[model samples]
Target: MITFSKDFLWGAAASAPQTEGAALVDGKSPTVWDKWFELEPELFYEGVGPEQTSNTYYQYKEDVALMKKMALNSYRTSISWARILPDGRAVNVKAVQFYRDYFQEMKSNGIEPIINLFHFDMPWWLMEKGGWETRESIEAFAFYAQVVFEQFGDIIKKWTTFNEPLVHVECGYLGEAHYPKVVDFTRAIQVGYHTLLAHAMAVNRYKNSKYNDGEIGIILNLSPVYPKSTHVEDKKAAHITDLIYIRSFLDTVVHGYFPEELIQLFKTHQLLPKVEEEDKEIFQRNIVDFLGVNYYQPLRVQRPKKEQFPAQFPSAFASHYDWPNKKINPYRGWEIYPEGIYDLGMRLKNEYKNISWYVSENGMGVSEEERFLDESGVVQDSYRIDFLKEHLIMLQKAISEGSNCFGYHMWTFVDCWSWLNAYKNRYGFYRIDLENQFKRSEKASSLWLKQVIVENGFPMTDERKG
Candidate 1:
């Protein structure tokens, strides 16, 4: 049988832009996502943008009620930078009131509010001023973090500096998925560097204020890197890939320095970001109190059989291969390897000295899920239940083996808009009926999860086979 600790946290996470639809209303300015969708509507599926999201701003009460039904004791939500700091500098009073009310409601429902400061929603105004590329903009972010901590200090305690820093830097700078899609590795390195500094500054402020006995940390999406073959070159490729993608941010805020080989690789290619002497001290002083890990899938890499095309980033230097005949999420095109979570957990325990951590984001995203709706208007998403069950079992195995993990938050609470992908992939426990004024219906997985949370865990025979 699989069981979790009585203190284990069971929750779901959602970001503001993906859930809150009042994008420009109530004194809220534009986030980078808001502006990006305006400029490149074609980039998003079905031309849907942040403004037409799950309308969480207005529907949060109903959502929280549903969360209570699911027995979610801890819920993670990001505070939009644009909503709080409309112009990137001046404070937005109305936005502050909204968040205060939001936090109050969550507390009223007995749900722990785990607030994240940034979740890729950089204000459009700041992006115009070079965004994370400049230290001045980094200071702007730090000030914004101070504003949030000061305002909601009494209600919220678990504060995350940023959600998925690598995703922000990689997708927005090197890849074409996110806003300001500049294909420059040098710029990516710069953004990545400043993001770590911003996190450090925020952590410093969080500790200095000591608000509500708060614990501050950053959420990172980590995946174990694997070599496709037993060849030496392939193993080397995987090692380098892991350093660039995982350790670049992990080692910096955790250890106050970049991985030697990662920095050397950047220096070898002259891709180092401009850094000031004061950054060293800042990085050293503001280590995280805990870690929030968002693990979805692992990366399998191989050495290039032929000379790869000239690339500007380390990720592009290596070729990737899917596991031979492995199970996969057919809808989202991602390989399903539940044991990878165990691998990541062990790595943190061994290498990171067993820092306290939690599974912040882990769930399956399925497209066109409406087809699974039964005649009774409920989605029999038993598949989603299986996905969660398999993953949770692995998480339990790690915890029993001495990993300092205490929480498990699925990817989302309700069906919310995803970036670039928009509403194509549904990861919510409650299926949002777009045709019926966004009416929420609980899928089978939600009911199962509610029971799992209620019982702290479920027996091994509980998961029904498809």
Candidate 2:
């Protein structure tokens, strides 16, 4: 009953820093993660750093073959800015050849490549120049994006300027989780504004480039905001939360402007970032062709009861609300709300001109997955299969009801290193045995997904029988 369209993109996504283990190899310079690990090795989980990842740089051919075996129509991954442009200004020919072969291998294996220009990894040299906080960094990013389009634009038809831009703004500037950790609300807004500007610049560049035949988009980690109750203050807080987290990037890229309410709030609080006279026009002129949404959980908020530690933080307007008895991923501690996908889809359809979108990343991460390995060495992860089915069923319903969603890509194809968490959690169709020479074996969920891809969708009432 829950069948997707014939041309639906059934795929998976991973980032360069997480998958490519050759962190310092072949003209690849240091990224923020590299420096952060160097500065504080004790911070990362189990002291595991970016150097010990899935080794996709060396094993991309085998990875692409696995994608073919799984019948994937697409695979989304980021081009390491540091790897491709070692110093953020010069192109690395070695990195270019590696990506060329990697992407070509995917195409040869019948998989379409969806390439993202930047994920959380910023070239350390760029960070030294103030990263996204300065206008210079924005221009640098535009130049880097241009080089990427020129290099791989023929092979990579689907492009994303950045993935989860808000994460860097919040995690890096507003919180201590990421590099250049500084608790500065004013700097956070600047970083976010500059990043959006860079995206607009990249979109404009791509539009006027010789490789203008393909589409360009930005990937957002969207989480629907829910008020704890129908109280006026709670509703107001929820709306503010939505404006901050979702609409900040979503509205700007799709509607070519930021939310006026968000602007007013920032102005009232004196948290506004400096802007150029031409920036407004620049944003109004450039809009994305499509959207790639990465949804893992929804945000529940209530009116703040008291002043938060960081008085200027977004949490001052709305505090987190723990929904009682909500189903959760124990390992990740994230609420499992499949219906959020339906709600998000409906919002896009009704508000955002029915923009074409796809689920760029969705998967369950479990810690200590080796405990689930059977005698045959396969990770018997039915939990992940159920998670995929439940989410996809909701997505299918949304599409059936006139949502313009075109595809669904899980979080990753193989288990890769997560920043900070490192390898504490595993989220992949192919389990990577770090101890056994990083051998990859398909999990039960992957087998189920292969059948779903083959059928274009899975049955709602019936199970995938052996």
Candidate 3:
């Protein structure tokens, strides 16, 4: 009974640094990821670096053919900032050709290409100049965005300015999980603000450019926060967590302002990031045309049992956020909460005026997938199929209730490299055997997705039972 619109886009997402091999070829400068892998190989899971990923840079045509076979009408991929602009300021003509050709190929095949301007791949040169923390780097980012808009805007109409800006703030700036690791909350706040500024600047530039059909927006990973209990303190903690994590960026991009709680928290801690008087106008003037929500899981918050740790937690830590007691799926540590999707849809619809949105990234990551393969070489990844089905059902309900959600693009097209996890957690429909020059093997979930796309709804029991 669950049916999507006939125009609903079904596809997979990938990033250049994650799937593209030949990291150093064709005049491409080293990115922060390249420098990180070179300096700290041990930081990655099992010591597997970004040197050899899914090899999609060389095999994009082959991969695109595979996507067509999977019945995809749209595809999402990021253009490496370092690839196009070697130092983040100057354009590389040869590198420009590569992406132009890539886009042309997708268009030729009747596939709509959604291009992301930046996807956590910071140029090493920019990092040396203070990266996103410095205003200079923000200007360089805007310039780079303008270059991409001018060059590829003819073919690529849908553009995402940044991917999961919160992840970059939490993981790279605050948590020490990604490159240029710095665990200062104040710096994290500044970085988060500057990223928004960069996005807004990019939006301004894209709107003023020659492209008539182009649209610019930012992609945020919106994880809905829940209260562990109905207690007043628990509810308050959940509210704070949501403001700090989700609304911090959502409000700025959608409503053209920062969350009031975030401002107060920074003011109380005396850790407010410096902002110019003119910056507020820039943010207000450059609201997004759409939003891309990447939903993985929801968080459960409750009152903290002890004092805050010696390490400075950004905001009030009177409470803690923890996952609710539920059956955990072993593939990925995230809890399965299908209703979170519906909740997020309703929240966006009510708070943000239901701006056009799409599920950018949603999937389960498995530790070891090769063991689940059947005799015919198809991996029986029923868990992934179930995960997608449950989420899609919620999405259908939300859409039917007037959410204005456009489409759904899964986490990835194939098993690609995750930042610190590297290849440890595989999250792809097409399994890539890294041992054999990255051989591609379609999993059972791929077949399931193909039928879902073709039928525009959940497949019958007989279709999925076999």
What TM-scores do the predictions have?
A: 0.97, 0.98, 0.96
Top candidate, metric lDDT: 2
lDDT of 2 by residue, 1-466 (tens): 7788899999999999999989899999999999999999999999999999998988888888889999998999999999988977778999999999999999888889999999999999989988898789988888988999999988889999999999999999999999899888989999999999999999999988878899999999998899999999999999989999999999999999999998988888888889999999989999999999999999999999776543488878899999996899999999999999999999999999999999999989999998988999888898998899899999988999999998999988999899999989999999998885358998898899989888777778756531
Q: Give per-residue CA lDDT, model 1, range 1-466, as digits (tens).
A: 7899888889999999899999899989888888889888988999988877888888788889999988999999999888888876778898888889989999999999999989999888888888888778778888888889998999998999899999989888987888788889889989999999999999888787748497888999999999988899899889888888999988887777888898787777778889999998999999898899999999999986565334465655577877886799988999899999999999999999799999999999998888998888778888889889999989999999999998999988889999989889999998887765368888888888888878778898885522
Error (Å) of candidate 1 at residue 434 is: 1.2
Off by over 4 Å in 3: 307-311, 318-324, 459-466
Q: Which is the winner by TM-score between candidate 1 and candidate 3?
A: 1
How accurate locally is residue 310 in candidate 2, as Cα lDDT from 0 to 100?
35
Residues 332-439 of candidate 3 have per-residue lDDT tens digits of 677778888999999999989899999999988988787888899998988888888889989988999999898999988999988888888889989888786458
Instruction: Provide backbone clash counts, one per model.
Output: 0, 0, 2
Worst-scoring 10-residue span by lDDT in model 3: 309-318
The reply for model 2, stretches above 4 Å from the true place, is 307-311
For model 1, what is the error of residue 282's alpha carbon versus the real structure, in angstroms, after optimal superposition? Answer: 0.8
Give the CA lDDT, 0 to 100, for residue 406 in model 2.
87
Error of 1 at 262 (Å): 1.2
